[model samples]
Target: MILYDEIKTLSDKYEERLKSQIEKRVSEMDGDDLSHHILYQVLGVTSEEGHDIDVYQNKGRFLYKYAGSFLEEAAKLCIKSKFPDSATTRVDNTLGVRPKKFEIDMLVPDGNAIEIKWRDATTDGDHITKEHTRLRVIHAAGYKPVRVMFYYPNRTQAQKIQKVLQDLYNALDGYYYYGDSAWDFIREYTSVDLYKILEKIAEVKTGGK
Candidate 1:
């Protein structure tokens, strides 16, 4: 069995490395921070009043789907670094027909089954409701549901997005987001380079104590 301290130590070290990488990528953006900015806009709050709902919906769909790809990349990093041997990462899967069609943002194999989610930045009450719906589907399908919320740097005008996420999670039924205080875990788990985390986990396992 993996000791708690060992897991914590490895998680911390990996998170530090992840923070540097994410910062670099954010800093390198030339135009607007397209991913986050687009996400907010697509959700329909960033523009002037009476923005066309149809246009917003189209843009939102495009942005959300694009972001799903990014989430998969991040998930792959997480699985590779922390649970390399025990995990297999996938973008989305369809198990059956009609109501059973679920698009997972990322799927990581935990001990007994797969953990899935729809990645989002803020889990504000409204957003959390939607997340909960997805979680319900996953639970019904005999898989573990994990909600992964991305923590971004606080904007000067917006008093940190993390608080909004917390409020959203608090309002949810029975489930909560796990990475706010444990952001160190996010840093350790995500990677810009796919498979890097898995390779690291393998190295650690190979050199085990």
Candidate 2:
């Protein structure tokens, strides 16, 4: 079974860290920081009015960074609980000069090269090239690249990027699982239902609602 207590502890720690960061950022929102939002200024948004937007934008960044990290680690716990021999490894990027190595989130004894992600909303075209190189290297190393992304992006551009990635993976003999399918894949492959564990923890957080 997966460690629910450890997952809960991780969630709590992330929450506290996020809270502390937000408090620190908001406290330090001085005149210089508040006055530099060019688009907000062009929209006739006063510094006082822009404060809310700045706060939320900063909060969004923190949330995005932490959310991805928390879910990836949680998924690792679930997978490693089932396959204790699995581990992360860095492979040489034979095709790239910039990124000399690509980090595989998990490498199982059976040759599954796992790439865990909570969400991917990248609209950058260069990201596709980097991922292609990464996958080619993985295939060259005899590991089947498998992407497990728990959440699907909401925006249209992001969805298009993901579609392209999915096609790239299939073309290269890699696997891509996202949204509900990703969760199901982990459950079936690892024999651990990650969604149920997170849902129960969330219920406790939301007062059992």
Candidate 3:
């Protein structure tokens, strides 16, 4: 299968694992919070489906949907890791005054953020440019942001995909995606273990701290 399909498949599996963990955590809690319910629903784990409809057209909507899924998993992991049994953990709470207009792939508390982008031939350059723009804005606003480019099928002939990513990082002032470092950040921020972070997050909610 193609890389996108592969990633999607893995994401699905990851979601299942995440769901289990979340359910277990909630079982231990005294009362349910709206933020927790919102997160659970957003990640597609909850049975309830509110206002099921499409907002964006074509692939744009699909991209946002997947990106949001990834971000929710990351946020859940981060909250569990940092707070564990703490009842005051606010995973979905916005830290800054900025409105939640953009779809951030993954985000961490204390201003650490990640924006994930997937590129095919049709919109690779556009995606890269947009990421750069967003990075600049975040940097200028004094927030630590990380850009993650997950290229599927690996068909770009101009240069290696890693090189392309490197060049993009080099062009940016404070953005970087060094080998394994990006994954490391993903792991740390998401609180999900490395081996099945993506896949498990897409599958069941495994027990986590």
Using TM-score, give the best candidate's number.
2
Give me the overall lDDT of model 2: 0.89
- Which regions of candidate 1 are displaced past 4 Å? 1-72, 84-100, 111-129, 152-175, 178-182, 187-209
Model 2 Cα displacement at 175 (Å)?
Answer: 1.0
Best by lDDT: 2
Ranking by lDDT, best first?
2, 3, 1
- lDDT, model 2, position 130: 90
Return the clash pairs for model 1, or none: 14-188, 15-187, 15-188, 80-197, 80-198, 81-197, 81-198
Clashing pairs in 2: none
lDDT of 1 by residue, 82-179 (tens): 65564543323343333345555445454223332334344355544454555555565556654444434345423334454345444433233443
How far residue 142's Cα lies from its native spot in candidate 3, in Å, is 1.1
Q: Write one digit per residue (lDDT tens) for candidate 3, span 56-137.
A: 2223444555555564454344444554442221122133334334454444556545555443333356555554555555
Of candidates 3 and 1, the better by lDDT: 3
In model 2, which runs have C-alpha deviations exceeding 4 angstroms? 30-47
Clashes of 3: 28
Which run of 10 residues does model 3 get worst, by summed lDDT? 50-59
Q: So what's the TM-score on candidate 3?
A: 0.40
Question: lDDT of candidate 1?
Answer: 0.45
